[model samples]
Target: MRLSIIRDAFDLVTKTQNLSSSKTDEVIDQIGLEIEIALGKMHNTEPGVDCKDVLNELMRNLLRIAPLSQMEGIQNELNVPLCEYKKILEKYFNPDISKAYRNFDIDTHTLNQIISKHFYREGLFDVGDHFVSVLGEPESAAIMKSPFLEMYQMLEAMKDRNLEPALNWAATNSDKLAQSKSDIVLKLHSMQFLKILQNGSIVETIDYGRTYLSPFTSTHKDHIQMLMACLMWIGKLDQSPYKALLLPSNWERLAEELKRQFCNLLGESYNSPLSVTLAAGVQVLPTILKFTNILVKKRQSMNHLPVPIDLGCEFQFHPIFVCPVSKYPATEDNPPMFAACGDVFCKQSILMMTRNGTRVFQCPYCPLDIDAAECRQLHF
Candidate 1:
């Protein structure tokens, strides 16, 4: 059904010539043409009109087709063109105009005039008048693209206490929004727009900014604007105390622990007891020391440090040192020595000397020699 209508609308748009002036008459004539095309496409050669299907098609065409024309053409002619009035009664009340009129004692001519005035003027005042008349006053008002119009309608409707039907109708057509075509005057009247900037959903901020913040307008910095909007949205939310604790110390600690656990899982000692391989011995100490420094600095920077100064800077944060490997001597009296190429080894190059040995030792990271004396433990 949608495809059929789209094809018809395309044909209509293609065949029809552009209105040079877009005068009141031309606009009205275009509306008549649209109605004719919709009727023809929904044309039934059988017993009667498929009233339900025809009505649905007509409303969809209005919602989709009409918006395209308004978007493409100049806005001045987008006013409810005159001929649109002829079909309003047909479109709105459906096949049961008598039933509708009887139900409410509403005058059809007055309604036609109201719709005509709105279609021609395309102003908030006229739109409000038409909406109030058609939907009838229990102020369920939402400005289609115009917050000011919505607010005005809402205010006008509020004067009358009976507003349920209007509210219900407004809610029903909530999705029938036009990208608000507002001038400076309309903007001046938009209070809800300001309120939403102060407090609204993330989705709403993006949507509103598309219209209000012109793409052509240059900002001092793109990132600054983006971050500012994010900050505004974040600042408005109900924050928790724990959200502030995400610091460098916490991050570094997490990384160190993860590395330690991973090495343990790989069957490697996190803190090597036997300096059997240079790689195994090198892995744990430097990483732990670096992380300790990071945590201490971060804690001090955050002003969370107390007594027992470690770094000895103005910030008195003490670092917790990891214990040295158990098998290694505590004193530098028998410290492990490395060769000239920055390879840590003791006494000799084991890999070069061994041939029939079940186990041999070497550097894991680079081509460094290892001590043979510690390699024959063979347990690991």
Candidate 2:
């Protein structure tokens, strides 16, 4: 309903503006025609043209039309809908987001770094530089900006179907990627091979695939076969069974994967850490405000949320382990531990069962006896 009101308001404004513009144009055309007729009559005179008569007639024509009043009326018409639109917007949106804010524990330097790095990550190099310069710590932020700058450059190159930069970066870090079980290098080579196949001879395509795409055959045999099968279709690969692989979406996915791998190589996450935090915070801020307004009105600190807030899966980095026995989430100080009997319990919970590691006890889920010393720490 609010958006419908806004649309209606803007529609009225546009209609009024068009009408006013048409009216003004018609009036101006009339005035111009009258002045031209007057000038023509004055110019065709047998004797000296009466300049005073022409000036008087032009003045009279302009006054009779009252162009200024008509313009003022048009201006008023435009302003009417504009004023109402502003009021409607202010009424419906209630955009005072400051109402949701609370002071949280973060130092000035940390905040500056986050803001500066976000600007750089977004490819706003000038903004980031100006910000860091004002902060008088430009040298500190220089190191963090270069990696993201290169990643964006590669992304831009890929936009133009140029893959050399990305391919070189992938080859340089192939060892790390292989250790992580990534086949993006092979995928890049396959894309390059496909490009060759699209415009070159079948023999040239085969030769390129042999030189570049052959190395991934051991691990990516099906993928390699798919590339080789394109040889049969050659210029008409769009009709082949592998046509789905020829989509622009394939390039988009490859670009995203390249960015992820690029960040990994830099020992950073695919998403900016500051972006993730703010995104998660945006989700939880409303609940925080609700509590602040009603339940926790006099709270001194917002270091920890007064209640649990479930954010979207994008914010979840790993599975949350809750101690089954205590029915509480396991924290780093009380991390979950795996028992030998294939059961898991929090370290504190396991300590309680084993009497602080002084005695052997039966597992809660199974009948097997277990000792706390035998329980291994679970990384997750």
Candidate 3:
């Protein structure tokens, strides 16, 4: 709808320009014709015709056909449509978004540091260094350089189909990966085996498998069997039963998995912090804008927004519990408690119903009756 309005305004401007051009041409043609006829009459009548009188007559004809006042009137009339268009647009204008930040308590220095770190995480080291230096904090650049630099180097190597750096990193962090139950090392080894099968001799491929693929056989037997089968069609693996093993997507998947595991080992999220925050903000901006409009209409302070904007499951990184009976959300202090029958309620509400843990109560959402002591605190 907004685009349509803008397009209509643009079309109107174009139409006005065309009309003005056509009107100007018409006036000029009329004046030219009148002057031509007057010139012919003067030439036929006498050779010594009064030039001043002809000029005056020509000016009068030009003024009558396209007067200055008439041109001004056309311009003024064209503005009327533009003014109406402006009014139409004003009706749909959103309230000033700056009003939403009237009470923001952000620290500029902290924000700058975050931005610098975000740039560093994205492998923009020069840009990050320049920012830190401009902010007069050269010492802080040391802290930002190491982790992301190593990560970026690993990613670069993976991009070139070189898994040596990634494999080394994975091997060094084996215990952490095992604790986290990550299969990134196995996946990387599989990728290495595929690379060998593609470019190396059959003997070399078998040797590579024995060294790397054997350990993962118990956990990934089917995949190891497929890799072993690829050796049969050494010269033509694309036509083998394990043809899917030669796909470029395997390398891509391995790279992604490697990055995820690397970040996991460092206790960082798989996605960059900046990306997650931006995605969440983009998802919630519309609801926030609508709520801001409501607050304006109600003449209320926009300092606090209504709870539970519902940005959908993707943006819900953490768990939220709402009491079925009270219809109120659970907090850390008063967490949701689950009954033996699998019903959940806020601690305060359940305590009230159980008479301060001195009696039993029926599950509000089920047929099971149980003592308050049986209700366990649920954690998300």
Candidate 4:
């Protein structure tokens, strides 16, 4: 809406300029013609043609049509649209984000360290170093250097279509990978086999598959079979049934998987904290701004917002349990309890239902009867 108003103002100014220029030209032409006619009349009569009266008449006509007063009027007309545009901007433009900042009270030093560490984790070594130097904490930069550096080096190798570094890293952390039940190693080997099939000889491809893929056959039998079938279409693999193996998306997926495994080994999250926070903010900022506007209009204090803001399931990182019996959210103090009959309720609610001089409480969801003492706390 603001843009539309500004565009209209611009168009009006342009039209006003064109109209003023044309009117000024017309006034000048009329004055010139009057002078020419007056001179012609006096040209054959006298030596000194005193055309003062004619000149005064022309000046009066020019002033009446396109004077300095009219220029001021035109400027006033342009100012109306411009003022309207400014008013619209002031109405909708919210530059105050202090409401959002009011909730956070992080330590300055901690915030700086976190930012510097984030820079290092993102492979901005020089930026991290400069930040550390500015903060007079060179040791922070030194402490954070090695781990992310190795991770990025492995990623760089993968980008270059060289998987040796990643493969070696995976082999070195095989035990931890197995404990996590991650299939990254097998997926990496599969990508390696596909690379060989795309560029190397059939003999070399078969050799590579046998050496790398055989270990994963027990868990990924069908995938291995499909990969081996690609060998039949050696040179014409694009038309083969297993052609999806050659897709660039496969490499991208492998890269993501490798990064996930790498972060898991380092006891870090798969996604950067800053990225997750920004994404969550993008999801919730609209609702927050709307609420803020409402509070402002109502002339109410916004210090406490009791209303819930739903940001959808995507932003819900952890499980949330609501008790069906109590119709309330389950918290640590009153957790969800699972009964022997497969029905769940808040602990306090279940205890209340069974405390009427009876040991057994009929399950609300099922026909089975169960004792409240038999209930167990359920964890998400």
Candidate 5:
């Protein structure tokens, strides 16, 4: 009888459409129930039994029956609000605000118009530019066929001004109906990004790379756009990876600007976590240098010189350390120079790019760069 129940649960999961939400929940719940019963049977078979063996057996069975979860794809899906996400997306395909309002609030049509107008004309493009970044193109046909696309169709109704159809679609696919929500939550951490410790969001940025593991559109434009969004967000918050903020300027000025912005954001209340450690030769600078050193050391293909030990030592001894002094000039006109438009990129970065046969140096911070041929002509 127990085996029959387990088999039935398996069949239910197997028969459901890949995009169906109901089957995801049913499969998980039924598997959980069977595991509990299996464990119960083991308990009843022996008086005061050591439950470890039974528990392990139950766990194995549960693992064997668990449905495949698109963990990364699901994580990307839940990161943004549904309506706002759909609305922002319309801008990329075209400038139409009609799609933006298709799912306008049934209870607040006027409000939906206001929100759509505000975003579509004002900030939706920027939002879509950023949003498409958070979740790349769907990885599977299952995802393209999922309720997410249904949400997109509902968005289409706004373009047609068909409020009834839009609202009906939204109603049928309510937020509460996302049965895979729990499975997604298990794999992601949801802390307010702004409220984390100073370095928190920087760490969160690493997970952005993981989204690529899911099969998505493999376009260079998409990758560059996603990187730009991450850099912009970090730059706005006065965050680190100092190289990311270089604009069309000298290294000194760029470094100074970043330092100023960081100080402004950190403010007086920041209590100088670095200073306290410096007074006693124990603190923030050393820890940061260690991290950077490890990252730098791990690169196998880098052609640029390493950061000097003296600099790391200085940071260790001092309470606070800012940008490194520029030892190299800022343009291709200078031998061993690398220019990206408004600013000179790191020598190491230039060396690496050159090694890869890349010629045109587009500065990450500002829009300044000669074409590959121009840069080559300038190269000594």
Candidate 6:
């Protein structure tokens, strides 16, 4: 429920933003076109189309469109949704984020490196360079600059709807990408194929496909088939069932995929490590804030959370098998064992109860009894 409210508020703000931009651009374009036509007539080299008459007509059309009023109306259209969105935000998550803050041992050098590196990761080379020059080390920036620069260049070209740079980069790294089990190269070509086909150039699309896409046929036959299916809908592809291929997000997903694979090739993470840390911290802040007082008191004694922190599967790096019976995490010496009723407990806990397989033991959480031999050591 909390997430839904936030999502709806966010969507309202975005919707208003898109509408505002569209309406403003549309009004400006219409006004500009009117001025261009009026100017051409006012400087009438053609016969007797009165300059005064053209000026009057222009004024009438301008008045009809009412650019200023149109803009004011668009602003009014935005006010309610935006005001509601702001209210929703303040109502839901008004936490003092400072409450979750904790001091770290990071010194000047490491902090500079992180700040400078984050700038470069976002493609702000000049800012990053300046930042490093002041109090940071420029060498740290240089280490990642080359690779990230190329990635930023591809991203820029992608923004302009030019895929050649990204396609070329993907082609060059085809071997590495394939070795890493990345299908990004195929994806790049697929987008390019649709782009060419959408422009009503069948010969080029087929030629490009035959040259660049045929190789992926054996491994990605289904995807290739889906692309080929679009040939029948060519120029009218947007009206076809496969129209989703043309969404703006496809390019975004491709760009992110390219970034991920590029970083994978360079043995780096796609997200800046600092960004990852901050994101994790944000997700955990609420839980920590709830137990702030207790945590502060036992800070030295506690090695883990007072209660389990379910960070979901994405943040979980490894399998955790803490035995419920013993209330301790599993280890090599005391591995988790599954009994007949599918209940798991530490090996030592079972041993103490069954006396090293001399007798049957009942499952801790269920009524089922089992011999020690029936229990199997659980692997992560």
Point to the candidate with the largest TM-score. 3
RMSD of each: 33.5, 9.5, 7.9, 9.1, 30.6, 13.5
Summed backbone clashes in each candidate are 6, 0, 0, 0, 10, 0
Assess every candidate by TM-score. Answer: 0.14, 0.62, 0.65, 0.62, 0.17, 0.59
Summarize candidate 4's per-residue lDDT along 24-129 as a digit string, tens digits: 6776787677767767755654656566765666568667766888767766765776676666655544556555544657799887877887887788988988
Summarize candidate 1's per-residue lDDT along 37-135 as a digit string, tens digits.
767766653567676776687677665645656545544333334234334434332342221111337787555544433432233456555655676
lDDT of 5 by residue, 1-380 (tens): 53465455445444442434554566678787987797678758777766787788787877666634544344334433343334444422233323212232355544333333233322244553343344442232232233333434434543443334433432343343234221111111111122222244665554543432122234244533444344455635445343333232433342233233322332321123333334433332343344444655886432332443244453453232111333443343333333435343445555554565767655556666544443322232
Question: Per-residue lDDT of 184-262 in model 6, one digit per residue for the tens?
Answer: 9888889989999999999999999999889989989999999999999988999999999999999999989988898
Please, what is the whole-model Cα lDDT of each candidate in the order they appear?
0.40, 0.83, 0.80, 0.79, 0.40, 0.83
Point out the worst 10-residue segment of candidate 2 by lDDT.
299-308
- Off by more than 4 A, model 4: 1-93, 296-299, 320-380
Alpha carbon lDDT at 354, candidate 6: 90
C-alpha root-mean-square deviation, candidate 2 = 9.5
How many backbone collisions does model 5 have? 10
Candidate 3 has its poorest 10 consecutive residues by lDDT at 91-100
The TM-score obtained by model 4 is 0.62
Candidate 2 or 5, higher lDDT? 2
Candidate 3 vs candidate 6: the TM-score winner is: 3
lDDT of 3 by residue, 24-112 (tens): 77777887899898888777766678877877887888888889998887777678777877776665454454544556689998888
